[model samples]
Target: MHVPDGFIDAPISAATGVVAAGAIAVSLRGARRELDERTAPLAGLVAAFIFAVQMLNFPVAAGTSGHLLGGALAAILVGPYTGVLCVSVVLLMQGILFADGGLTALGVNITDMAITTTVVAYAVFRGLVKILPRTRRSITAASFTAALLSVPAAALVFTLLYALGGTTDVSLGKVATAMIGVHVLIGIGEAAITALTVGAVIAVRPDLVYGARGLEQRLKLRVNGELVDAQAPLEPATPRTSRRKLWIGGLVASLLLAGFVSFYASSNPDGLEKVAADQGIDQKAKEHASADSPLADYGVRDVDDARLSGGLAGVIGVGVTVVAGSGVFWAVRKRRSTSQAA
Candidate 1:
């Protein structure tokens, strides 16, 4: 959920800002180990894909909708550290450009939505992968379970944060109950989306999916009725061109989703918005600072056609997020190379 301004006080907000910054700093270093020539480029595509899928909010309840949080999906496709950066990029783009999230509350959104989700999801995924069979199906299953739990975990973290620095005097217990209940349902949608997307990628290019790495069983050959390990003779390692193709394909898919398919997303309020409206927690919600931006509210300024306006805004968002995310990841990749050289 994109927490708007005035929901949390200045002190707690600033505290979260520090925490978010520290987390990003740590992730930048950890992502160095996760990113390589094959994964660095895909990391940017994963961010763009998450941005696109988030635009398609699906109905969860009678008046509530949910969208892909992307933490598990990104972590499964790339890695945990990179996943945090991916979601952070999307939240930043939405806040500053689309006015979807508030600028003042950027830290809250990043901490709760990006950091918490990625940590919890990746932890669960690793744990499951350790116990489950090492196969693509097992990886997908683990991804689904991790994604399902991450949403509610994030809701709980937010509720705790609100309890500590809530602007209103609402009952913390009631807020927790409502937030967790609604987000649990929302997590089902998150799991399905995460599983399907991870499954699709694993099917096409398991080599590119970080979570699926080492999950493939070694092939065996029958040599004169004896089973023999299929190991190739020593040869010079070939560069991965298939990964580049996959990255290009993923970027194109993200463009298509945001540019055109986003028009069909459900118009109903999302899980957090619905809970806030019902729980009276949104009483002090402040206007977004970027509300005056031309692309505010996911619509182009002065575009009379609802479809065209929203479509253009979505496309612009995809473009900005990809550029921003790619820049950050590319820098991280460069630092990684420098460190290795040193």
Candidate 2:
């Protein structure tokens, strides 16, 4: 969730800021091992796609809505460390450019949404994958389960943060129950999206999916009574679809979702926003620092048509996120290559 300003006091927020910064620094180093030439660009695209999908809020309850939290999806597609960077990039873009999250509390949003979700979900995913089969179906199943749990876990984290530095005097027990309750419903949506997206990619190009890599090599055939490796091809099997084509298709899907489908997204408050207003969490909420930006509130300034304004904003967001994320990943990749070369 995008934590706005005043939900948490300055000291805790600053503490979270340091935590976020340290996590990013470590992630940048770990990402080098994860991102080579083949997967580096795709990692950036995955980040942008998450940004696009997050704009499409689906109805969850009578008044509450939810969108893809994207931790499981990213972790399944890309490595967990890179997954953290992806969501972090989206949060950074939203905070600075779209005013979706507050600048002062950007660290809170990153810690709660990006770092917490990715770390917890990926841990769950790895544990499940070990016990379950290594088939793509099992991967998809693990993704769903991981995503389902991650949202509530994040809510619990927020409850703890609020208990520590809440700006209001709301009941901590009530806050925990309510936040976890609504977020559980949101978790179902998160699970479905994560499973479907991870399933689709694994179906098309399991090689491109970071979490599925080892599983591909483990595919075996039962011969007589023993498990044996599948016969290796003398030559590499020709890919049915080119990486360029897949990239193009993914980009198109992202554009369609954000540009057109987003217009139909439920206008109700999302799980966090709804819970905040209901639980008195927003009693001390402050205005976003970038509220007056031209692209604030997911709309272009002075655009009369709501649809066009939002559409343009969505497109611009996708473009900027892709560029920024790619730049970061490619630089990391280059550094890795240089170090190896030297």
Candidate 3:
């Protein structure tokens, strides 16, 4: 959920801000180990894909909808630290450009949506992967389970945060129940989306998926009296054209989803919004600081046509997010190279 301004007290907001900043600082360093020639570019695509998917909120309940949080999906596709950065980038873009989330509560959104989801999802994913068979199917199954649990974990974190600094008088128990209940259904959708995305990537390029690393154990060959790891058969190197095709295909899919398909997404309020309206948690919610921006609320200001405005904004968002995310990852990759050289 994207917490709005004034929903949380100033003290709690500032505290969460500090926490978010620290998490980002640490992730920046950790991501260095995760980003390589194959993964760095994919990381940016993952972020952009998340942004695009989040725009298409599917109906989860009668009057509530849910979107892909992208934590489990990103962590499964890329790496956990990079997943955190990926979701954080999306939140930042939403807040500043689209006015979807509150500027003052940016830290809360990051803490709940970015840090909490990624940590919990990755932990669950790794645990399940270790216990389950080391097959591609097992990876997909783990992705589904990890994503299924992550949504409720985020809701619980929000409830705890609200209890600490809620600006409204509401029953904490009711809020918790409602939040958890709706998000559980949302979690199903999350699981399906995460599983399908991870499965597709694993099918095409399992090596590109960080969670799928070491999945294929090397065969052993008997040498003399001892068995030793056999050298893998040398295969033709993957062509640069093939890599370019994958990247281009992903970008085109993202554009189509955000620019065209999003127009038909459900109009119902999401889980958090429905709960807030029901539980009075949004009584003191304030307008976003960027509400007056040209691209606020996922539409271009002064654009009368809804479809055109929204489509244009969505396209622009994908473009900007991809550029920004790619820049960050490329810089991290470069820093890693410099350190290795030193």
Number of the top lDDT candidate? 3
lDDT of 2 by residue, 1-342 (tens): 789999999998999999999999999999999998878989889989999999999999999899987877887788999999999999999999999988888888888898889999999999998888657788899999999999999899889989988999999998899889999999999999999998887777777888776664355788898998874422126656677887888888888888888999999999889989888999999999898999999999999999999999999999899899999999999999999999
- Model 1, residue 172: displacement in angstroms? 1.5
- Look at candidate 2 and give me any clashing residue pairs: none
State, as a TM-score between 0 and 1, how close model 2 is to the true structure.
0.95
Per-residue lDDT over 33-80 for candidate 3, one digit per residue giving the tens place of the 0 to 100 score: 999988999999999999999999999989999998999898888899
Backbone clash pairs in model 1 (N, Cα, C under 3 Å; residues 3+ apart or in different chains), count: 0
Instruction: State how far residue 27 of model 1 sits from its true place (Å).
Output: 0.5
TM-score of 3: 0.94
| TM-scores for all predictions | 0.93, 0.95, 0.94
Better of 2 and 3 by TM-score: 2
> On residues 146-246, what C-alpha lDDT tens digit does candidate 1 reach at each position?
99999999999999999999999898898999889989999999999899988877767767788866554446899999999775422114533477677
Clashes of each: 0, 0, 0
lDDT for predicted candidate 2 compared with the true structure: 0.88
- TM-score quality measure for candidate 1: 0.93
Query: Which residue segments of model 2 deviate by more than 4 Å?
Result: 216-237
Lowest summed-lDDT stretch of 10 residues in model 3? 232-241
Better of 1 and 2 by TM-score: 2
